[model samples]
Target: MPSLSTALARALTVTAATVALAGVTALPGAPPAAAAPLPPGVVQLGDGEPCPPATLCLYRDYGFSGPAYGIGAGYAIDLRWLPMPGHGGPTAADNVSSWVNRTAGVALLIDEQGGRTRPLFPGQHLEEPVPLNDTVDRVVW
Candidate 1:
């Protein structure tokens, strides 16, 4: 038999290992988690209206009326992974028609071909982007 101190140390080590993995469980068939949600301090916007202070808002329809996504300033997003709720499981990519940028810098809409639209200035909003509609693949602000 081991010494009393040695046995106690071994038991303590086992207890520590168990506690370290207390809440971890195996994910058998879970899909990869890569999509991210908007940060805090966000709000919904209306047609041709400005975003809330330091916020960026994207709209699926013109006039900010359908399936809006809002985020705080200082964030760059890949719209391909942003799931659009109530849209039959489509993404935000190539579906952003109108948006409002309230950050200090401009918001650039990048297309799938690495093309970028004109700068969307801070505190500015577009209700209907005739050429840019359904052309945005990503957004950097």
Candidate 2:
């Protein structure tokens, strides 16, 4: 039977070879690749533009355009408390077209009509119109 040290050495060799084939340098005890830095005023979400870090940002239009509703971290916000940007517009409740979550913890969007919930992890961005658009009643951590 192979000793534990021998097994570990073999694993390291395999790992180094795999890393080299994948075009990444494998330094001894090196950390994994770090996440890319966020851009100014945007938090990247899976290749999409992101919201500002440590904020929960809601946009009136897709691609982070139009009116913006920004909330600080660590609060459970009732969407009804947020009004539209301009006069005569609807409340933020059920009116969020897109969102970016930059909080430390996962954020949830609770549906006002059906009590359904959607989870948004830290650094997640939703660029497309969500099914819960015009239906989100609350944002909770």
Candidate 3:
């Protein structure tokens, strides 16, 4: 049989491992245990504005108004490729104010090609202005 000290050390190791795992699971950006459902009555469009199903949409105004852009699945669009609506055709870079993710997978807002990325969960919507607004240069599935 192991000595008393050996048994105590083993217990401590197990306890420490459990605590570490708990911390990791609680960390930000960890995958959720289950996907969350969208809130009730949250349609893809409002006031005839369009945010089509199975697409990731960006808006130039809060509350999903103003110029809208939609990206479909299996795409990695650079914001520079999108034009600002009615603004002399300026690139849409750093111009997105709100967004909705209607696709079945997460969407990522990238600051630069292969740079920092923020995840927009599937079926998620953000009506308010985002800090990453106008700073996003790329979107990827």
Candidate 4:
């Protein structure tokens, strides 16, 4: 025969253990108890533009019973004409590269949270926050 005090303590310990186990199961890391459905407004990468001149891309994992979601990549591109007096051959390539560099810097900040969007070339890197000199001239179109 157990004392009342001992029985109470054992019951409390068992209850505590069960509650603790339940808590661990509810944690974000735990697999949800009945697969959750994807949230509304979730989208595939390139399905929609995040903002004007900006693009957003998403990475998904479909193996889970629930719809997949992950951090997305966003980018922006702006094109403008730089006045060149007469030259137009190599200068054209230089102008394109310059524009790409500027836009890439902005994209870096946009995609920094996900670490996506990289330059096709080896020497390029993403820039965070916006560059101080990235002034833009709006096109009439």
For residues 28-133, what per-residue lDDT tens digits would candidate 2 score against the true structure?
A: 6856544333323332233234466688887766677666666777678876666454332455676667887778888888886877888988888886454545
Of 1 and 4, the candidate ahead on TM-score is: 1
Tens-place lDDT per residue, model 4, 61-115, is 1111111112113322221222211122211111211221212222231122233
Candidate 1 lDDT score relative to the true structure: 0.67
Clashing pairs in 1: 47-63
- For 1-141, candidate 1 gives per-residue lDDT tens digits of 999999987876666556546732223333333344443444444444545677778888776767777766767777766666544237778777777787888887778664665677888888654765677776676
Global local distance difference test of model 2: 0.68
Reference-based TM-score, model 4: 0.20
- Candidate topping TM-score: 1
After superposition, which runs of candidate 4 have C-alpha atoms over 4 Å from their true positions? 24-141
Error of 4 at 83 (Å): 54
Q: Which ten residues in a row have the lowest lDDT in candidate 3?
A: 35-44
Clashing pairs in 2: 42-50, 43-50, 43-51, 44-50, 94-134, 94-135
Give the count of colliding residue pairs in each prediction. 1, 6, 2, 0
Which ranges in model 1 have alpha carbons more than 4 Å from their true place? 1-50, 85-89
| Candidate 3 per-residue C-alpha lDDT over 20-118 given as tens digits, one digit per residue, 9 for 90 to 100 | 567432323333433223223222233327788888888877777877767786577877666565332365677777888888988888877336788
Candidates ranked, most accurate by lDDT first: 2, 3, 1, 4
- What's each prediction's TM-score? 0.59, 0.58, 0.58, 0.20
